[model samples]
Target: MAKVRRYSSPYLSDIAGGKVVVSCQRCGLERRYDSAAMIERAGDVSLPELRIMIARAEGCPRADNVYRDRCELGYDPECWNGTRPKPTDVP
Candidate 1:
């Protein structure tokens, strides 16, 4: 099985093989990522980029219409992976 890590900036390969744990701030929806489907849809893109583009597009978290979908990667906070990404890291 592929390794799942929780720290910072993940490469395209990370999401491509392993799983990404994501949760919503408003509703607290947690789930793993479907790498195969993602690759099929968006080709090869980094996890951070993937989050920004297509991370959570599954609509409302609870479907109660209480709060809008504010889905975000539970582990990642902003762009910095504990330490800021170098210029080369920012594609």
Candidate 2:
């Protein structure tokens, strides 16, 4: 038998081996990211944080007011392991 790893969190390092994908229902956009690369650039940020960062980088209207958090970033089912943090879940 072999041990298996699970990515039950939203941290970049946790999902590094699997696909790091996020999609926005409101914006109608989906994006895939290189987890290793992102970790190098931004350390191991949580999905909520990453959502805000992506929203800002991609010019999402809700990026300006993260408290309202209209970015709606959700993990694609193909790589989902746990309940994805909502936009307002950012720290």
Candidate 3:
């Protein structure tokens, strides 16, 4: 398995919905994947692979989208530290 990332649906908590933005590596293309909208298939495919599958289905075989963002947790820019803040941290 690849490095587990907090932003991917496979590793994120189900209770707190999150969103993932996929930016293509070949041609500049961005797609948002929300926790609520993702359909999990019965297989061993990882989230990154799934992302590549999505990219391929969309007519791009490069399937190398590196731009991913974790939007539901400590990523808020309004945090006092000018960075993502934890739940207990001041925002």
Candidate 4:
């Protein structure tokens, strides 16, 4: 049998029942992405991959950091600091 590798982050398709938003905590950059459209476009990319993609797309200086100071880009609320609710989650 071939060895299988598992990733700790969720694939884009694994996110469910909520709006998908990517944001940068340090610079206050943010974007709301349609999850279904994203899944169709990227074909189930892992959230970590998507985070880097977003950071690069937005020209974040820390996009390529591979050490302790990683880019702050992440899926909203859940992956990021959860103090604020995702915009869609607000009534």
Candidate 5:
């Protein structure tokens, strides 16, 4: 008999406001949620849960389009000394 590993879905209650943002490593499109909207929807739902729902509704995983980088948590590879752009001072 073989066992299968099941993955659990992320919920809104698992994240906080001002913590969720969308960024694409391929296109470098970064976007953040509106603070006003977060406040308005903070009564009965969590930001992470809402994001997951919206991702599903949009037919994509937030981790795929929004946080597709080193990991689902959005850790930039360059930050860890990987082959990416490094911060530099421009004249």
Candidate 6:
């Protein structure tokens, strides 16, 4: 089987203070990302650019809500591998 990929949205806005909303095309999951944490991880890169890079790195295409129908049927290019790290596994 082919490997599944994951992706995130590039356009980020402040839904609330200190937290930014992020959309995952692969899983259709909307989650909040810590802006400060992201800035620290992507020093020198703009937020939008960093979002795009992160999405592509995870194998998701930069698209809009126009593809929502397709994404519902699981046609998303970015799919998760269904794995999670346990507390004991954390370094």
What's the CA error at residue 41 for candidate 1, in Å? 1.7
Per-candidate clashes, comma-separated: 0, 0, 0, 0, 3, 1
Q: Write candidate 3's Cα lDDT for 1-91 as tens digits.
A: 7555544454323312455445544465655554445544313344555556666666764445455532211112223232443344556
Q: Write the per-residue lDDT of candidate 5 for residues 1-91, one digit (tens) a residue.
A: 8433232544333343433454456435444454346545653354445544444543554444553432132323233232433334223
Best TM-score among the predictions, by candidate number: 4
Once superposed on the true structure, which residue ranges of model 4 sit more than 4 Å away at CA?
Answer: 1-6, 77-91
Worst 10 residues of 5 by lDDT: 70-79
Over all chains combined, what TM-score does candidate 6 have? 0.37
**All candidates' lDDT scores?**
0.52, 0.69, 0.45, 0.73, 0.42, 0.42
Residues 1-91 of candidate 2 have per-residue lDDT tens digits of 8434344455777677555778888877777677778788887777777778887888887775756655677767554443565344558
How well does candidate 3 match the true structure, expressed as C-alpha RMSD? 10.5
Tell me each candidate's RMSD, in Å, in order.
12.4, 9.9, 10.5, 4.7, 10.6, 14.0
* lDDT of the structure predicted as candidate 2: 0.69
What's the distance in Å from true for residue 9, model 6?
16
TM-score of 2: 0.65
Error (Å) of candidate 4 at residue 77 is 4.1
Q: After superposing candidate 3, which stretches have Cα over 4 Å from the reference?
A: 1-16, 40-45, 64-91
Q: Which structure is stronger by lDDT: 1 or 2?
A: 2
Question: What is the Cα-based TM-score of model 5?
Answer: 0.32
* Superposition error at 62 for model 4 (Å): 1.2
Q: In candidate 4, which residue pairs clash?
A: none
Model 2 RMSD vs true structure:
9.9
Residues 4-48 of candidate 6: C-alpha lDDT, one tens digit per residue: 323343322221124544465457555444555656665435445
Clashing pairs for predicted structure model 3, backbone only: none
Better of 1 and 4 by TM-score: 4
* Model 5: colliding residue pairs: 11-49, 12-48, 12-49
